[model samples]
Target chain A: MVQKYTSMAYASADDLVFGKAKFPVKAGLGLEIGAGYTTPEINYAPRPQAGKSKEKLIKEYERITTDSMQRMVQIGAPSVVLETEHVEQMTNNPSWGGEVAHAQKTIMEEYHDEYGIKCALRHTPGDIREDRDFLKLRGDKYDLLMESFEQIAQNGADLLSIESMGGKEVFDYSILRNDTAGILFGIGVLGSMDMEMIWSDIADIAKKNNVVAAGDTDCAQANTAMFIAGGLLDKNLAHTIAIVARAISAGRSLCAYEAGATGPGKDCGYENTIIKSISGVPIAQEGKSSTCAHSDVMGNLVMQACDLWSNESVEYHGEFGGTSVQCWGESLAYDCSLMNVALKTGKEKGLRDLFTLSDKYRDPQGYVLAYENAYRVGQAIVKDGTDNYLRTKNAAVECCTILDEGIASGKLRLTRFETKALAKVQADLAALPDNSDQFMSDCLTKYKEEVAVFRPENYGL
Target chain B: MLDLKKEDIDGILIRYNVSLEKEMTPDEAAEELYPKDELIYPIAKAIYEGEEDDVIDGLKAAIDAGKNPIALINDALMVGMGVVSQLYDEGIIFLPNVMMSADAMLDGIEYCKDQTDEVPEPKGTVVCHVAEGDVHDIGKNIVAALLRANGFDVVDLGRDCPVDEVIEAVEKEKPILVTGTALMTTTMYAFKEVNDKLLEKGIKVPFACGGGAVNQDFVSQYELGVYGEEAADAPKIAEFILASGDGIEKLREEFHKH
Candidate 1:
């Protein structure tokens, strides 16, 4: 059905690149970061905490925002969206308006001062009200929420992003097409975003909104979106493809901003650029081993996910679907130094494996098919290792150990969970050639040895 | 590829068919269509196609002819269902087709069960649900359908289920594997709650969590929690749980081993 629109979205999507937004696009080897956070304290808040005085809340945000912004600069982010300052509201309670406003001001001041980086602030969806009709009726609170974005925009913020519970609300708001100046809306389909409700209107909303919509990192949500978009597969294939589509669709400039939650000890989402690439359409991922153990895992994930595409294509269509012009094939990597910065022994082994392998295959067009083929072989390894990965105690420890060794050797760099060992690994890996086979092979041998020791047979599968 | 003639429909329908279309009680059809050699593939195909009338008549004819329900289910109905699943997976078919196929398969199976007089062992009950705050259940539904087709007795808790309900199911059913799915961060933590509650209760069921908001790393962090990377991972987890012989700690330990 042809969709009717309600409002104009003023944000210009012309500046928005598909894959990696923050990182410059390098024809040879591009790197972009996945920036943002999902602080659980906000989600698992104290009941009274939700109603914390704006002054108190803004103070807390001030501390968090300062750190987050500083980290963005340190990590080499070209542009950063100031994390949303507004919290979901509870009805008939003390409002968080005061704190949210203060946080907004703090972010604005910092962004204006730090002109080197592009800044965007997300609009809060406001408190959960059972009155579904409130927004339609232009209820006072709903009007206030819309006015909040205007206030943010008028206050000299570079971009205004509207966040809701999911896409359905966005569709209902008719903002995707609003395309009004300085205003944009991004939808998150992952985690608690109503898939069925949102899906019914998403494509139309996207078309009407004409605002670029962000796909999620959640495998199921992405898969559901893909299926609704015309791809079909069993549950397993769906999950795998969801990651690929979400990443690939994002393209090179904004690969890191592809929506997913990241925080300490959360696995529902992955952090590596390689997993992001392989899981979705191919694109270059930036940063070093932030959420992964070694560069090899990025290569491993990319190759494997690519293999799923290639193999599935051949099985059904009898020919590998080339990386179409629409799909730019690039290697993705992540920070894998989170596991350890302390244990000094296996650091070099992990670093060498990642740098050497990824460096050799960094060419986007040259080795696309080959990468996919190698990934198919890796799938077997993943399958075989499934039993080991499932182990609660020994397996978790072993995986952590692998992460630690890579970080120490300078091969893996986990941004969120930093360790001293990672710096050493990064320094070592930086010295290696971009494509040295001999160096890679030596690294692999050492990795095998480390795996033998750190992750003994009994420890894994 | 085997082309059985339309006339062969007599044989295929003799043992299985949807009773809604055939105007026969499951028991009546079972007694009359027993040992029917003719009613195999066609009846199964009819069920897969959701040919309600044809399926009912076919079951009765097959049963009257003395065909075993298990054989008909395995050879025809199951075969057709497999084809439907493959088609659905390949995008050749869709969700409605699968639901229709499942409905047809179940109708014939019911007749057979009625005839057998012995209850089929619930092939390892599994507790499955979407996590709290996560309202999307389409993915979960697909998993449920596939699991049921693969011979699992699924204790489906439906969409947007609370963590407590999931824990209660684990406590009540003692399923070999309990799974939680969340499509959003809003509800993914419900998995953690289930994991914590089960651990608290000393029930060591393998907890598999998957969906858009779920990640293997997060699942690995929790005790007794095995992050299901996909919906298909559920059956594999169930297999592991059953093989462990109710070894909950072993299951937890095994999940973390990766």
Candidate 2:
């Protein structure tokens, strides 16, 4: 019972970075934004106008979402995510939350009607119970979500994302019962106990169905994501590691993005640099406060590294255990490449996390080449014959070491030119120092300046 | 360090173990199950881990030991809870652990009081709740637990609580601080309603509001509206108002901006 994965991903993954060419929208890629009119913070607005029927409030929410989706389509976004709250969850309506589901479906219809793009309706039930409590759904009121989902699919939902935050019970049920064109797990914040198990389960399902695993990479801010971010837990590193591990083993692509700074700016890494707290991770600390942006910068780099290594690790097709490709740690070379791009070339592309920030794999081989070229010179210092770093504990050194186990079989799919380029970068990074902060900071400063333009006014929903 | 096993310790929750971060390690799990203090460890262990039965049984035993009521209060129980506060801050512990720990701490204190005929006055009373339109209270629940652990008597007005109910609790309780949490945008306005009603009644209670959807800009718009950024800020806010006596304006100046 070996795991199968996608091995026939394009020869040049860089070309697929911004997502596959949009016949109308990016195929197999989409961003899930909590739609509805919200205040400066992304909470449900119109709370002031109370006693409005569920229908009326939903209509207002749909109107606001329709506007946002049109803007998204204009920007060449491949997929749109529209989520609906339970009638009981939203207002005190007992009419099965059907209208609420249909309201989301209508937004999808309107988006398709206008831009003809596919939309994923994330049916959000209030009871986001985990495996422990989710099983209590036998006769629970949330069964209405299943009913509403049927109608939405019939009306033309391109994708039915079981919005089970960290809950898999509902996800399993949705995929089994629904006849939607596509099934995905709306894992905004994976607060589950066994994340690797969840990814494995998702991979198992993708073996048979067209499935995607999406998550919010904002790291900290709200209910679940906040604990990871504000606590300064080292779980961020675990997340990237798990994604690549799963990418090689699971037959699904991992999609991760941010929820934006819609809450306290300092808490969510909005405008502030880093705010120190007792909960901060020790390794990610600067003086006292956790360097929030630095952790994120590292997070972005690790994920892109995952894509590169996973892209070449296992020769998985949609078929299960097609070819047992050992991951020869080719991704390590890519990571070294990125470090060179950041430190030597002084480029911002070197720092982007492909899962959350970009759709493209920015010049990974180029960065590796730059790193290798520098290591040959005294551009990077090496301490102890073993401790090679661009700087002390350079972020890339830890990141690449994280993927040292995966050994892909067969000669890597790199072209002769690509192969020479990668070899050159690997050579340059051979004796680098672990001083990542210097290289990481330069890239982060540039990244922050670039990302400031895309901050959403609101965040939590 | 005690030789007691997990099952012997009683009250540690193995399930409900997932947080945004990693799972609790076996060391943390062991520390939680077995109280460090060997003497009244049962009480602390019961409270810290998850056992009401152990708490009750241990309290009776301490009373039977004829332990000095006051000495027991200051040394054994407080020391255990001090560890709890630190573990909580480190995100190494859970609320149920703290809640049961506080209960054990209180039961020991109460047993000592009954024996010595001593009745200690509570440090202060605090009223907490989620806003009228929001039903999410896990954050509020955490705040109340921390406040209780820190020695304040918290009157929790449950989530989806109406403005009148919160104001009623505040008026009746005459608390030092009244806090409301909301994770929805629509319900944030309810914080303003509570503020206006409190103002109308000439009750000048400090109203703290925060949660997922609450913004400093939004909460600051209402009177007596001081924004609490996280649940961890709850006990700190209580200590601030009680210690400084600087009122709401001073709090706003320190913790929030327009």
Estimate candidate 2's alpha-carbon lDDT, on a 0 to 1 scale: 0.40
| Model 2 docking tier (incorrect/acceptable/medium/high) | incorrect
lDDT of 1 at A200: 28
What is the DockQ score, from 0 to 1, of model 1? 0.02
Please tell me what DockQ candidate 2 reaches. Answer: 0.07
Stretches of candidate 2 off by over 4 Å are: A1-56, A76-79, A85-121, A128-140, A143-158, A161-461, B1-76, B79-104, B113-117, B132-135
Off by over 4 Å in 1: A1-64, A71-79, A83-101, A114-118, A124-223, A227-461, B1-37, B45-57, B67-104, B107-119, B248-258
Interface Cα RMSD, each model: 20.9, 19.8
Give a tens-digit lDDT track for model 1, residues A1-461. Answer: 32211111112212111222232211101112222110110111111232245555455545444544554455444443332424433122223443353465566466547645443332333323213222121245444544444443333222222223322322211111121100001122111223222222322332343322222233222223333323112222211222222222121111122222111111112222223322332222222311221111223333211101111000000113222110111111012221112113434324323333442222111111122222222232222221211111121122224444433544232222122222332343344433323433443354344222211111111
Model 1 CAPRI rating: incorrect
Specify the highest-TM-score model's number.
Answer: 2
Give every candidate's TM-score on chain A: 0.32, 0.35
